[model samples]
Each structure stands twice: as C-alpha cells, then as structure tokens.
Target: MGQIYDLAIIGGGVNGCGIARDAVGRGNSVFLCEMNDLASGTSSWSTKLIHGGLRYLEYYDFKLVRHALLEREVLWQIAPHIIRPLRFVLPHHAGLRPAWLLRLGLFLYDYIGGRKLLPPTRTLDLTRDETGKPLAPGRFKRGFEYSDCSVDDARLVVLTARDAADRGADIRTRTRATEIRQADGMWQVTVQDTATGDRSTISARTLVNAGGPWVENVLAVGAGVNAKAKVRLVQGSHIVVPKLYNHDRAYIFQNADGRIVFAIPYQDDFTLIGTTDIDYDGDPADVKISTDEINYLCKSVSEYLARPVLAEDVVWTYSGVRPLYDDGANEAKAATRDYVFELDLPGGLPLLSIYGGKITTYRRLAEEALQKLAPYLKGTKAKEGWTADAALPGGDFDVSAVDALIAELLRDYPFLTPAHANRLAHAYGTRAAKMLGTAKSPADLGQAFGATLTEREVRYLMANEWAVRAEDIVWRRSKLGLRLSKDEIAVLDQWLQANRAQPANPMREAGARS
Candidate 1:
C-alpha cells in the first residue's frame, strides 16, 4: 500500500495549478501532471488581458461578466509583478455600435466589479487626445477609455505552480496521465514520463480533469467515462507587429461584423492585435493561426488605424483553442466563458472534470471547486479565500512600486541597462536579485544569449522554474524569442542539453570558487 494523495490533477494550465495551490494550502496533499510544459496550451494563448468581457453584456451574461470583473482586482493585488492596470480606448464608430450603447456597457463595466484602485471610465475627445492620432484623420470624433489589466499569462501559471510546489504539492512537467481507474476505494492514475518512457501508478482519494481543450479526450479515452463531451472548442488567434503608436493606451475597435478587436502595446517594441471567434473541430494541439485569420485581423485593425496593418508587417502569429462549455449557443462568439463542473462518484471514488474558464476567474473557480469537494477532503483548513491576499512568489511588493524596484535593480547592478532591469523587475519581481546573486559585471552573469538573457538567468530558470529547453527559456520563461536569432536559439538549446546534468547551482559554485 502506497501513500494516496488527497487530490490528483491532470493539467498544468492555470486552473489545475491554481486548484493545486489552493488545495495544498487547505491541508490536502496534492499531485499534478502536465503532458508538456506549464501553460504550453490555451493558457498562454490568451489575448493577455484580465478583463470583464464587456461584450458579453450583449449576450445577457451579467453574472459571468461580473465574476470576471470582480476577479480583476483580486488577481492584480496578488500578482502585481505580472499584472498591471491598462486603459483601453474604445473609438465610437458611427456605422457600428452607437455611442449611447457603448456608454451604457462601460457604465455597467465600471460599477458591477467593485472597482477600487483602477481608474474610472472617462470620455476621450479623439480630436484632441493623443489616442486619436493613430486613427484615420477626421474619421472619428469621440471615444471612451476604461480600465483593465494586462498580464504575462505564461508567468502567472508558472508562478502558481511554483507556489504550489513550495507548499508541498508534487508538481511534475512533461508527465502524462495515460489511464485512470478506481480500486479499493481510491482513484488510481497511471502516469508516464514523456521524456524517459517510464510509467508509474499513483492513488488519490479524488481526481480532477482540468485538461482545458482536451477535457473530453481525457474523459472518454483516458478515464473511459463513456459520456458525451460538453466542451466547445473555439479558435482565437493574434498577430504581433511593430509598435503602432507612441502612447501607452490600447485600442478596442468595433468591426462591421459585430466583433471587437484590440491593438495593445506589446514587449515595448511591438503591438499585439488579435482574436477571432470561430468554432473548431480539430485536435487542440493542431490549432494554428490560418491565412484567413491573419488577413481578417489585419483588415479589422486597419479599419481604424491610420497606418494600415498588412500581412507583411506581422512579425509573429499564434493561436489557441478555448475549451468553452457547450452551452448550445448558436454562434461560437456567444458561448459562455463561465466554468462548469461535473463530478462523478463511482464506487465511492470521486472524479471531477472542469470546462470553460478564463484567466480572470480561475481563482474563484478554484475556491468554488474546493468548496464542492470539501466533504470528500477531511480536516482541510478553513482558509477559503486566502489566495486573494497571499502574494505569489516574488510578487510581495506593492503594485505602485514597480518603478522603484526597477530603480533598485539598476542601482545594484550598474552594468544593467534600463530596459533589461525593467524586464527583470516585471518578470521576477523582488526575486530578481536572487538570480543576479552578487554579480559585479556582465561577465559575472556569464554569456549573453542576446536580449539581456544571460547564463545565470537561464540556470536559475532550469534550477528553480523547470525550464528544460531553449523554447521554454526563450518563449515561455520570457519573450526573448522575438529578439534572439535562430542561430542564437540553437546555440542556447545545445548549451542546455550539454549541461543538463550539471548541478542546479553551478553558477553559485563557480562564483564561490573564484
């Protein structure tokens, strides 16, 4: 007889990691496995906004909107390092949504969410405001600005997993849950390490299938539940291009097709514009931004911007399949973003499956999920809403103090550029110092892998954050991929593979030896 976990989760996305953190915090032993890397799926492919889905108001989903809106501040407070307030400038289109209607939606958006720190909505005079300069001349007269938050979506998941691991939860990446069964009053899960081809079986008192887009496949194939899938796969895509405007504000443009598009400032040197809502029926892993999607997004933004966005200007494009709960909506765009749970207890063993949740509401979803499973988890702590206040790893400082943190980094490391210090401050927060670790010069940080990424930082990611490959380092850990050449990336990949077996603290050891 082996130790049976209180919870076993089969997903490394936001929901699964979040639940793992909350469950373990509540005194339940937890184990979580991801098929590839953390946030490697739909979680990282979001529009990267923590918003209330204001358009959902038209669909009469006030509850979902309100829940998401309320969560915006809570998420910002806990992970201020990766999340910050962003102002969206919505230009009034005479041919599309009327100004009065937009005002009404903005009003509901401002009041329903218990907004405290975020600025209130204000009217923008496009004729005079700098935000209007990007739009075609004399085409629009009025606009409105409202508050939302932009996030480093991938970092959020990784940090959550890191926190869960710190709290005694067993977190494993590159692991797959192949088969699930019940025996001896415990749910048994057979997991395989994708890297080594080794298999092992573990027992848990309860199981969770937070597989996102693959939730159905896990239930029908892996768990053999013989139930119809309730997930609706919707493909949303985004394209990144050179920075469109000089200002910090983002734009939300209304199209003739009743869809909304956003052009947000991305990575300091580029602008991110995206997101189409079309139903998809293919493997979630195969989802990609199609030619049609790219053309459509470019045209959608071009309708408003003075400088037309063409396909040739796009530097990168990515897509993800949102596993929305199949609420029987006629159009994919109308599908609900609210989460739904299906709990099955066969032979007194519990298995819970989750469907359709957005990043903004993941914490609330986790809290509610634990509440539903409370009866099954004995002696769990009564910290129902602890996550709302607890800061994630490296995010313990005040949100307003980001500039101060950046200044401190530059003062401590005079060898660092302002841009490099800013990136480090946001990505690692107060813990940036831990990676720098008494370095006096750029050489002390080791080889520069381009774009301010150094050997010391890469080793820190591998040692603490489960970064295994170059893609994990350049793409997920940070977006240095945009700056690093292909040859540079390959060099990094080779270096990581060759040094895979080295000690996690090799840099510190080398420094001490000197």
Candidate 2:
C-alpha cells in the first residue's frame, strides 16, 4: 500500500543516477535505492576519462566511438567543475602498429564525433617537445597528441543523484532491493536498510536493474526473472604511484600485447597507471588488484617512462569488475563497451536491465532507457533531450571561470590557504560557499581531519551529499585518504559515530528510506 512510483531504479551508479535525474526532470515520480554508497562500484573505479575509446576503432565499433566522442564536450560543458579537457600523449612504439595507422585513428577520432570545442590531433616531436622529457631516451622519437577529458567520476555520480533529489526524486543509499514481484499490473519491491536492518515494500509501475556487475544476479535472484542476456565480468585494475612527470598531460602507451595502458597525472602528487583486462568469475564486490595486475601495470609503463616503476613505488591500487555484454569475444579486452538494455514486459509490467556501458556514454544510455520505458509509463509528463543543456548541481559556471571563482573565495575567506581554496573550488564549485558559511578563520571551519578536510566540510557532506561513513568522505567524496594518517581517519570515524544524530541540518536528512 506504499506510494506507487513511476519508476524504481535499483542501483546508485552513474547510469542509475543519470536515469533518475533525466526521469525526474521530465516530471516522473522516481525512487532509486542503492545497497551501498553511490559510485562505490565500477563507477568510481574508472580510468576517469570522458573519451571516444580510440583503441576500440580496431574492432570497427565506429558507432560506439562516434557516440562517446561527441559526449566529451557535452559533459565538459555541463559539469565544467569536474570535467575538463585533458590532452593525451600517445608515444609511437616502433614494434607496434605503424604510425600511419595511429594517424588515421586520430584523424577518424577528430572528425567522427563532430568535435568543435576540443583542439584537433597533432603530431609531436619527442626530441624537442616537453611532453617527451620524461620518456626513455631513444625509445620513443615521435608521438601524437589528442584531446579527451578527465573527470571526477565519483563526484559525477553524486552530483547527478543530488540533482535528482533536488527535482523530487527519492534517492536512498544503503538500502538494498531484496525482492521484486509483479502484482496486479505493478511491481511490488521489497527493500532492506543495510544499516538498521529495517525492511519495507513499495510499488512501482516500472523497475530498472542497473546493478553493474550484479545485473544478472539481480535479474535471477532479486526479480526471479530469467534473463536472456548474459554479462561478462571483466576485472580491470589500476595502480597509483608518485608523480611520473611534472607536466599535466597524460600518456597512452601501446604495449606489445596489442592492449594499451594510460599514465595519467593524478591528485597533484601521483600518477595513475592502469588497467589490465582479465576474465573475472568471483564475486564482484570482492574484486581487488592482484599481484600480477600490479606487475603488469608497472612493467607496461616502465617500458616507456624514463624511470622504471617498481612494486615498491606503488602507493595504492584498486580494481573493478566491468559487466560487459557477452558478445563471445575471445579476448576480454575485445568485449564491446556499448550498452545493452533488456526490457521484459511480461504481463504488461516493465523490468528493464542494463549491461555493458562505459562512463562516457552513460548520459546517452539513460536517455535511451527512458525512451524504452516511456510506453509503460502513462500520464507522466516526461520529455527528452533536457539533460543535454542542464548543468549539474554547483556546475552552473563556465569552465574557464574556475580560477576566477577561486580568487573570489580567497578574497572572502582570507584565512584559507591557496591550496585549500583551490581544492574546495574544484570539489564543490559554487557550493563551496555553502560549506564556508561566513567562516573567517580556520577554527571557525572546525577540526581539521588532515589535508584541509574540516569538520564543517564533513558535516556538509553528511547533510547535503548523503555521506555517512569515513570512507565515503575520505575515499569517494574526496581523495583525502591518500594524505590522512590512520590516526586522523580513526578520529574522524569516531566523531562521525558520536554525532550521527546531530546533523548540521536536521530537516534535510540523508535520504530516509521511506
């Protein structure tokens, strides 16, 4: 007898949140539930690029490449604070594909996507260009530079969910959809609160299973629906090390194995090198970087860099299992990155399940999802193509104005250091002032949890951002975990536990599971 929503999405990854935002913007009643925190799955563990998948051209996936290539500027324009253009340096390897092929790929990449805002590709002289300063001498003589955009992947998901909430969509974190059944032409879903062990049932006209790697399990176990489509769980791992180069440009090194590896500037002090693709059959939640993956990453990047990266140089490592649609590709790296939707409308009730998508195409996927469900959703005044022009929360300003915003914040809060102010502007954009709240001194902001993470910011995250655990604030919300000591993290965790009931704003609860 609970409220019957127009759509009940069972996941909090980027795709689910994106769909919720688009659906709610169109004036549909939406309810989204996540068993864990937002972006805690493969969403956060991306290579963090809004790119056209230049490597995918070998497989002749021209449609997928063109679609993602076009989204690069679109995402950058909307979320300028978190998404910005990043030039990638592709060093020519003599043993790999010919330079002409690389040039052709870049040429296709430049023109296929209707690229306008980003600069076109150009050949680089490794002997003279600054981009080659950190490369091994005589190993790489020529390179190609192309455009893509880097993203704060976790923040993208959080902001999308926040925008949905602002538009009247209910977003519940730490709530798992335990069961789903069709009853009287509607879906009866049973969801459980992971924290409090409370259970509730809600009804919805349509259901969405955006469970990422758990998409198949959700269909078989949660909904009791047999899925005709299968998901191939491929594990990709990455490693973070001390800064490999002083410049901001990232590197794309082609390996002899026909796969590519990226060495991207990360967190101001580290370089992110990654991604080994291997078939994964274990539980997705338990995926972790293996010794072989680390060794492979180190060796792969060491081949091109001036200094060799060893296991001792690794600062951190993380892994995620990608739920790619099984196309029977012999190699895991060859699996299609395009999204597939399986809509089952048995007895006239809709259950849509998603599989195999990359971060760059999540917006397009969401738009397509809504279009598919539009037939089942009656009487809802929903529209399409609204998200293309809509800016995410706190991202209303132009991308070029971030520096000016930082300067304004400095003038207002003279007590903030330059680094702290810059960090805040990048993370929260215009909403940084909300966390500052007339504070004039460091003490006014509250207890420092290392690396400019103040109690004020923590409380702001809890109240406005649906953050509860220390890891949520330290790892996902921000990468302050790399700087905070274990003792500092423990203190913050203890304080959070002690102040659970005393949120900064009591009225704005962190998505109560009604």
Candidate 1: residue 295 lDDT (0-100): 97
Name the runs in model 2 displaced over 4 angstroms.
506-514
lDDT (Cα, tens digit) per residue for candidate 1, span 1-514: 7878999999999999999999999889999999999999999999999999989999999999999999999899888889989999999999888899999999999999999999999999999999999999999999999999999999999999989998899999999998888888888888899999999989999889999999987786456475454899999999999999999999998889888999999999999998899999899999989999999999999989898999999998889999999999999988899999988876777778999999999999999999889889874778575799999988989989999999999999999999999999999898887778888999998888888999999988887788899999888889899889999999999989988887366335435211
- Across 197-279, the per-residue lDDT of candidate 2 in tens digits comes to 99998899999999999887777655757898999999999999999889999999999999999999998999999889999
TM-score of 2: 0.97
In model 2, how large is the Cα lDDT of residue 451? 91
* Global fold similarity of model 1 (TM-score): 0.97
State every prediction's TM-score relative to the real structure.
Answer: 0.97, 0.97
Candidate 1, run of 10 with poorest lDDT: 505-514
Cα displacement (angstroms), candidate 1, residue 422, comes to 0.4
Worst 10 residues of 2 by lDDT: 505-514
Residue 445 in candidate 1, Cα distance off native in Å: 1.0
- Candidate 2 colliding pairs: none
Superposed on all Cα atoms, model 2 deviates from the true structure by an RMSD in Å of 2.3
On the 0 to 100 scale, the lDDT of residue 230 in model 2 is 93
Pairs with backbone N, CA or C atoms under 3 Å apart (clashes), candidate 1: none
